[model samples]
Target: MTCRVLLADDHAVIRAGVRAMIQDIDDFTIVGEAEDGKETVEMARELEPDIILLDISMKKVSGLEALQALNRHSPECKVLILSMHTGPEVVLEALQKGAHGYLLKDAAAFELRLALEAVRRGDRYLSSAIVQPVIEQAVSKVNSNAEHTLTQRQLEILRLITRGESTRSIANGLGLSVKTVEAHRAQIMKRLQIHDVPGLVLYAVREGIISPDD
Candidate 1:
């Protein structure tokens, strides 16, 4: 079956480059392109592509916002985030928001094809450079200490904080107010018994909430 794809990015050069890379794929077809997040959302609904490949840092409406809109309007169309930012916070935010896969902008052509195929098969994919260590560390930590007091949401927020996301960014990404994110930050710190951002980052690494790459 042919997989219809929509490419969304603010840069014409990037969209063109990805089009060049993907145009030869046997079962993948580029059905449309959008230069911004809002256009992405609109094209996604109108075109009904099987997958959307988008950058995270669009100008007016961010890719995260487009992902949310897709979730509401076209849940069947999978979203794959293609970004230059490899921060764990950014990756996790995309996953939590409903991205089927995440790939770095610098990913090799083979890896890009692999990610597209994986998501088309209804499997999640991540850049190999970041996935193995993250999975191993998370599994090891969970096995070593299965019981934790933090709620999953709190842990997620903590991970973002440790990954260097500002509270406002976290709020915008998660569709919460800045004050709500700040409250969650305070609660996370209180629960972890860590008062400072650096301390929280250290704790998150130790607990495997995020990798040490931050």
Candidate 2:
């Protein structure tokens, strides 16, 4: 089956390059091109493409924002993040926000094809260049004694925290007071023995508490 794809990027040249790459594949076809995240979301809802090649730094809505929107509004469509960013934080955030794959812009043309195929098969894909770094970050251990001691509510709070939600936002979304949220956060950190947000994020990913595939 031909996979219909929407290209979303701020750079025309990058879109053009992607178009050229897709044209070489027999089972992939470009359905539309979007210059920004807002347009990408809009077109995604309308076109319902099988996959989207999304850039992370688009103007207005931004690629991450678009991914979140698509996760809610057009969930059936898979998104493959195409970005220059190599940071574990960015890659994890994209996956957590519902990107099917993350492909670095500096990756070889063949890697893009591999990413698309992986996403098409309903598998999460991370660029080979970034896999080791992300794995290394995830190697931090959660406190063994505390691992099974967390309440479900504490796990919920931890999930939000790792997803980059501010305490106030988490409180508002969870319908709790800011002070209550802060207290819960403190408890979570204490139980996990995780001193920092990065550590918390890595722990969350490693423990399967929150995932891109979710």
Stretches of candidate 1 off by over 4 Å are 132-214
lDDT per prediction? 0.81, 0.84
TM-score of each: 0.65, 0.68
lDDT tens per residue, model 2, 14-87: 99998999899879999999999999999999999999999999999999999999989999999999999998
Worst 10 residues of 2 by lDDT: 139-148
TM-score (C-alpha) between model 2 and the true structure: 0.68
Candidate 2 residue pairs that clash = none
Cα displacement (angstroms), candidate 1, residue 195, comes to 30
Determine the C-alpha RMSD for candidate 1 after optimal superposition of all C-alphas: 11.8
Candidate 1, residues 52-133, lDDT tens digits: the string is 9989999899999999999999999999999988776677668768887889999988889998997787656778676645
User: For candidate 1, what is the TM-score?
Assistant: 0.65
Q: Where does model 2 exceed 4 Å of error?
A: 141-214
